[model samples]
Target: MPDKDAGTPRVFLIRHGETEWTKSGQYTGRSDIPLTENGEKQVISSARLVVGPGKIINPSKITQLFISPRKRALRTYELLFDEAARHKFEGKVEITEDIREWDYGLYEGILPSEAKAGRKERGLDKGRPWNIWIDGCEEGESPKDIAGRLDRVIAKIREIQGPYMHGEKPVDVVIVAHGQILRAFARRWLGFEIGVKLPMMLEPGAVGVLSYEHHNVDEPAFLLGVNMAESEE
Candidate 1:
């Protein structure tokens, strides 16, 4: 007999591997840059460690995948799972704009320091330094805009996971995207407002996990630490 709690579904959030802009601390949004050679290597190594049968992210259990349309993110997904592994969820992959990086607009391709200086020169931040969470980009999507789209994605995830929460099967969803957006997605997954300062970070090639507490869909929470399954012989 299967453990009744085993059916609780989970969402795996993955940030794409490093790019030149990422390595240089630039705000890369909508730039469509490909991953660096090291970035490809990073994803491949990560797959070996965390993705496979019995691993933290068992590819066989993943029923759906939400990916950003950016090439870097697309490439990360390509490297994260090989052809045979991806075949396990052939038609479950969705490439969507909703998961793309937060649009930096005038600040795109610039470093955070440069953005802050620009905002200060423009007399925008007035009393405080420019924080994307609160002040958002001048011509880009605001916190409200981000919440709107992420909310849609979160709704779809809940709808899919609801039916199998108490069943005997496993249902895991995967998301591949950029840093800021994935972090924001996790924040929204727990019903938090993104307009306030949240000291969260997801590095390039990193992964985070979110799931319901005690198999209750109404009680979403982050899995801070999970023991990795031993590699199969």
Candidate 2:
């Protein structure tokens, strides 16, 4: 039987598994890096234990799947769902640039320390500090730009949720993407402004849930560190 968590709708935010750059603390924006062997194994385990017939994400409950255009996110998505469950999924899986990692621009392929040092050398920091949310990247997106892009996506997700929240049908959505973007999405999901430091940290291969507090769409909230033990119906 197809499982359904009727009433409140949810948007599951998944961070892709580890990559070479991720392990080395390098900025990996728009880079097409594949996951490491351990990363693959971790996600495979996550799929088996966290997403299945009677798991945190019931295959029958998914209404839509959003993925970043990057290879890591795509691989994570593939690993998060088994072949049979993927075949059984009736939702639309869309690869959107909107959910891609924040373009690191001049900071790409470099560590934060290197970028900050470079900025200091160039007198860009003005003797203070460099915050991506405030100062942004040299050639990449500002916080406001990211907010604008994600807000549009959020609006579309809300459109999908309207019917589900109103008792029309069950709708659960999933997003597989990078760490920074997923955190930003969660903050924006609750209508909060993006800050220099995000309120939460999303570890590699971690999953977070965003939904209404008590079945009211107006009161969106984040279910921090959602584990399979607490989510199973």
Error of 2 at 42 (Å): 1.3
Q: Looking at model 2, report the run of 10 residues with the lowest lDDT sum.
A: 224-233
lDDT of 2 by residue, 1-233 (tens): 52333357889888999999989999999889999998887788777777876577876778889899999999999899877867766448888999999999999999999999999888887866888877779989888988998998898888888667745565788999999888888878878887745567887887788887656677777765454543433
lDDT of each: 0.87, 0.82
Candidate with best TM-score: 1
- Which candidate leads the pack in lDDT? 1
In angstroms, the error of model 1 at 115 is 0.8
Q: List the residue pairs that clash in candidate 2.
A: none
- For candidate 1, the lDDT comes to 0.87
Q: Please, what are the lDDT tens digits per residue for candidate 1 over residues 1-233?
A: 74444557889999999999999999999899999999988888888899988788888778899999999999999999989987777899999999999999999999999988888788787777677887678899899999999999999999888878764456789999999998889889999988755788887888898988778889888988766883232
What is candidate 2's CA lDDT for residue 41?
A: 79
Looking at candidate 1, the ten consecutive residues that score lowest on lDDT are 224-233
- Find the number of clashing residue pairs for candidate 1: 0
